[model samples]
Target chain A: MKSTLIIVALLLMLGGCKSTGGPTLYQQLDGKAGIERLIDSFINQIARDEKIIHYFEDANITHFRDGFINHLCALTDGPCEYIGDDMVAIHTGMNINETDFNHVVELLINAMNELNINHTVQNKVLAKMAPLRAEIIEI
Target chain B: MSMLKFFLGFIACLLPFSNFAGQGKLLATPGVSQVEGSAGGGLVPWAQLAGYATDDEFAINGFCSRADVSDYTLDVCGAQINLFNRVEFSYAEQHFDVPALNTKIEQSITGAKIRLYGDIVYSQWPQLSLGVQHKSLRDGAVATLVGAEKTSGTDIYLAASKLHLGALAGYNWFWNMTTRYSEANQLGLLGYGGANSRQKLLFEGSTAIFLSRDIAVGIEYRQKSNNLGLGEEDWRDVFVAWMPNKYVSVTAAWLDLGSIAGADDQTGWYLSVTGYW
Candidate 1:
């Protein structure tokens, strides 16, 4: 009975090992479905944020949502390609200031909180997105 | 403490009028006011300016701190103004009580700082800043008795700070390093320069890990110049800070000041509160 129990524990451990080999950041964000939900939440947050709503008044929500999903998916190593316009190209004429940019980040964080995303995962996502500030701001 | 109350009351009065105030930076990014009224940990000043003002905004802040050791008690209260997130100006009054001497020492510090480069979180490099503090001793009798040369002095410092996301076991890691040149003894409370009449370059450092969005635990080390040679040892502290939001922050620390005025093993507890506008 002891040998059988040990074998059973070994099998369970082996099963866990298969999933732990390397879960990409994309998988940690719960893959495509999770990304969609996050984008939807972000949209709702932006829609209500009066401080930055003006900047998006002319935006095509469907296109922006699709592009953001793809961008985040590719950035996090998901099985997707973001072939849309580069960050600089898309943000050049917007002339977003530092405060507005930071406000957007705050709104995104709030959206993630509403989704019950863990802090560690949220931090990872922000880290991946932070580098885009240079390409998106003051243009 | 009446002055401290007045400052807190002043901040409270401004709260209703500050609809656009504190909306620029992320919450808890400005840090709490240090002992000397600069934005930093309890003992060391950081590169970030005080308050949550961005390039297009301005903010004001008030803070009070108390430190109680085995032999003495130090009380400080101050106010700060941040302009466009670029410059900071501060004024603080300090009172130190010594029951053994049955007397109190008083001093005031005026400080100004300017940001030179980068941002704490968004930039590729650490933020850099330059600061200056002018200190004046209100009670100079003790300084004269201790063989100090002057009752006033100026300190100049350069500081750099950065925050790394998910760097410490999935928590945010923040760090600051500062170098100062000064001749102040016990931060000018005991006066400036004693046996050593010249200013010395000193190093200070602070590091913290954000356990969550609203809390940070940290440590700080400040190298002191023993101009008085009264066994004026270095200062170090371990601290925990709680910022429920941008409106207020409270910090508590365990301080090890080593030695001061010929006394040794001066360990203590410190508590501080900062209110934002």
Candidate 2:
């Protein structure tokens, strides 16, 4: 096809971008199971402490958990729609202070350690979530 | 004993999901490189610079070392571990709410980008990627949002970056030009029957620079369309990152300045840490 040549020509012009050290070092991990297990690990880390989980007293654990997972999956361009609650609605009245939100974030790091996930994927997810800090913390 | 069992069992169950987005993945993004800092992107480039797909890697590996007028914020959290591979995907959610006024708002970002070969600096013949950061807004408190409530919109962008071998040479950059192609949900749009949404388009750009192998820096300037009525919006930051080891990275940044809704003009800080399996 003419388009194929254009594509090949473009690749030649741009150097056809290839890896230097070895074959691709990464692959798309399994979707659902991988994401849910991560959520559990993350939530459990936050739940162990009374400070952060305390805010969830009036909140439903399942609802909150599902929301967290869906939101994360959607953010990563996964094929899912986050449906539990609106971003602001869930955080409303919960009064998630910067400290609380941040502590949980710490727990999240620990969870990753326990899971032994690679460092690169970890940063990819965190980068996706960083921009939301302003709205979630209100501070 | 049951508690201990539960804890152990939990980790066991999660072990299989090892490769998902965990601490290690977060460690790579430039800004917020650490888990306990206040700076958003002091030493890294913004996530937007990654060109939508969260896993795009240009040919450069260095820390960003820049300061935002508000706080030194690094943006590049990281490049994908998959090499300069093919693929792209991204999504975002924006929220607007005024508790006192009992109003609410929301927005979504859907992005996808693919790499273009050859380096920005051409040393390693870095990869280049083109993507879009679409913004979809829905709200009910537009008038009270402290600024214009451009309901829904999306932006297209082109990004090119490179990675150098050592301490002295490297640079990364990303630019986004989004058009306001949807409704400007006024946050109070309680279904005003049939109000037509306006057509307002805007252009914005962001860039990141590297100063050393483990340290990097950058800044972003976004020119808002005249539609928002806020004239122009600015977000500038500089950050420093410490990659003691590839397994972990710590970053701190100072971000100063403003946005559409407005910041206190106060300096802000961010700390981040990322690691992997």
After TM-score superposition, the amount by which residue B2's alpha carbon in candidate 2 deviates from its true location, in angstroms, is: 31
Model 2 chain B: worst 10 consecutive residues (lDDT sum): B31-40
| Model 1 lDDT tens row, A1-139 | 2332354345334434423357877998899999999999999999998988998888899999999999999998899998877889888999898889988999999999999998988988898899999999888
Chain A TM-score, candidate 2?
0.74
Give all candidates' CA lDDT scores. Answer: 0.87, 0.42
True contacts kept of 1: 0.59
Judging by lDDT against the true structure, name the best candidate.
Answer: 1
Per-residue C-alpha lDDT of model 2 across residues A1-139, encoded as one tens digit per residue: 2332353345344333433443222222247677788889987887788767777777778977788778877876678776767667666666665435645665776776678765445544554565576566542
- The two-chain DockQ for each candidate, comma-separated, is 0.29, 0.02
Show model 2 residue runs off by greater than 4 Å.
A1-139, B1-84, B94-106, B119-126, B138-140, B143-150, B163-212, B246-250, B259-267, B271-277
- The alpha-carbon lDDT assigned to residue A7 of candidate 2 equals 39
lDDT of 2 by residue, B100-196 (tens): 4464444444445554554222224434555544444454355334344344444454444443221121122222222222233221122111223
Cα lDDT for residue A35, model 1? 94
DockQ of 1: 0.29
